[model samples]
Target: MDETRQRIQLVRLLYVSRAVGPQTTAVTDSILSVAQSANRQRGITGVLCQGQGLYLQVLEGERGVINALYNRITQDRRHQDVQLLLLEEISQRRYADWAMAHVLLADDDPMVQLHHPEFDPYSAPGASVLKMVADLVAKGERIRKTSV
Candidate 1:
């Protein structure tokens, strides 16, 4: 396929990162505001799960767009140690309706205890993290929807 075709290929990318400063509501809201606006225009959809100063996010969109977004995220001062957990072509988006959905997990959240005693995205497998995000999304009240 041509470069253009390759760039437009639909894919899902999951990543984990640590917050540089305090994980405040204002900080998360600011990130969502920018993400929702830009993602809507770029045709990106995803979910962001944050807690304990860590961010676990799944982004789905054109391969090139998502790649570029990830690169930018790695450089953002607000985040550190950004690690790509999963990246693969997908038949369809799991969070198609959301430009960016937010999930705030407390240290005591049950989802964290499902697979492990403590929530540690870096130590967890990519698939497990993805499943956790999926489960969180399934619980409507747990996710703050920001649809495109």
Candidate 2:
């Protein structure tokens, strides 16, 4: 193993937060830009999915970087009741290709198929949401490659 890899402790954290501001394009775009820049510098990658006035984000990076970022997120006025759903060390990133991929769960989006009328991440098991995200990303990658 490389020394750099040995010293690096990769971690992934999944959290759910309620959006304090309007979930509009202008607001989301502004937040996305800032998150991408900051995450890129820290070598972090993840996805942010918005739906039902809530935000579910998966952040993967070095332990220290993830910790600091999550701390700052907790303090951000835009997020309320920032509850962590999952946190664990990982050998590799699941969302390595994106600095911070943004996925807004619209009624017409393919991802919305996973979110039915009864489904709720806040009350449902965390693993279900993780699986949903994994499937969503996989389907997206297939479409991206085929469209190319």
Candidate 3:
């Protein structure tokens, strides 16, 4: 079999959680640093977005790897009311270029301030939240590339 055809199964998982306490920049940076390294080592890639005291993340990788990571995430004390919103196999990864891209939305960001006034990611429909994240990631990439 070709190398690509013999590769392990891939899956994507999306989840949302409420922070247990205030999430500061320093804390978020530290979390991103650790997660990026760990995820890279485990063949995982994903994007993490935060706003309104909530976290919305999309992770893609091998089925077993994602499952184990999700298990650990569920047990982590920093998050509460963790909910798995999406989990399914995929032929390709959406965030394959990012080991763990992190986006922290300011309170004044339009998504949180205007369009979705009273936005609660944890309570929002899973598909909509995923679409939002996909859009945000695309925009971020465009900005990043233009600046390069």
Worst 10 residues of 1 by lDDT: 110-119
The CA lDDT at 135 in model 3 is: 73
Candidate 2: deviation at residue 32, Å? 0.6
Q: Can you list the residue pairs that collide in candidate 1?
A: none
lDDT of 2: 0.79
- Top TM-score prediction, candidate number: 1
C-alpha TM-score for every candidate: 0.92, 0.84, 0.85
- On lDDT, the candidate that comes out on top is 1
Q: Candidate 2 on 50-98: residue-level lDDT in tens?
A: 7668888999999999999999999999999898888888999888888
C-alpha lDDT of all candidate models, in order: 0.89, 0.79, 0.80
Candidate 1 per-residue C-alpha lDDT over 1-148 given as tens digits, one digit per residue, 9 for 90 to 100: 7786565589999999999999999999999999999999999999999888899999999988999999999999999999999999998889899999999877777767664576678887899889888987786656799778
- Top-down lDDT ranking: 1, 3, 2
Candidate 2 C-alpha error for residue 89, in Å: 0.8
Candidate 3 segments whose C-alpha is farther than 4 A from its true place: 1-7, 141-148
Backbone clashes in model 2: 0
Q: Write the per-residue lDDT of candidate 3 for residues 43-108, one digit (tens) a residue.
A: 899888875788888999999999999999999998899999888889998888888887766677
Query: Residue 15 lDDT in model 2?
Result: 90
* True-structure lDDT of candidate 3: 0.80
Better of 2 and 3 by lDDT: 3
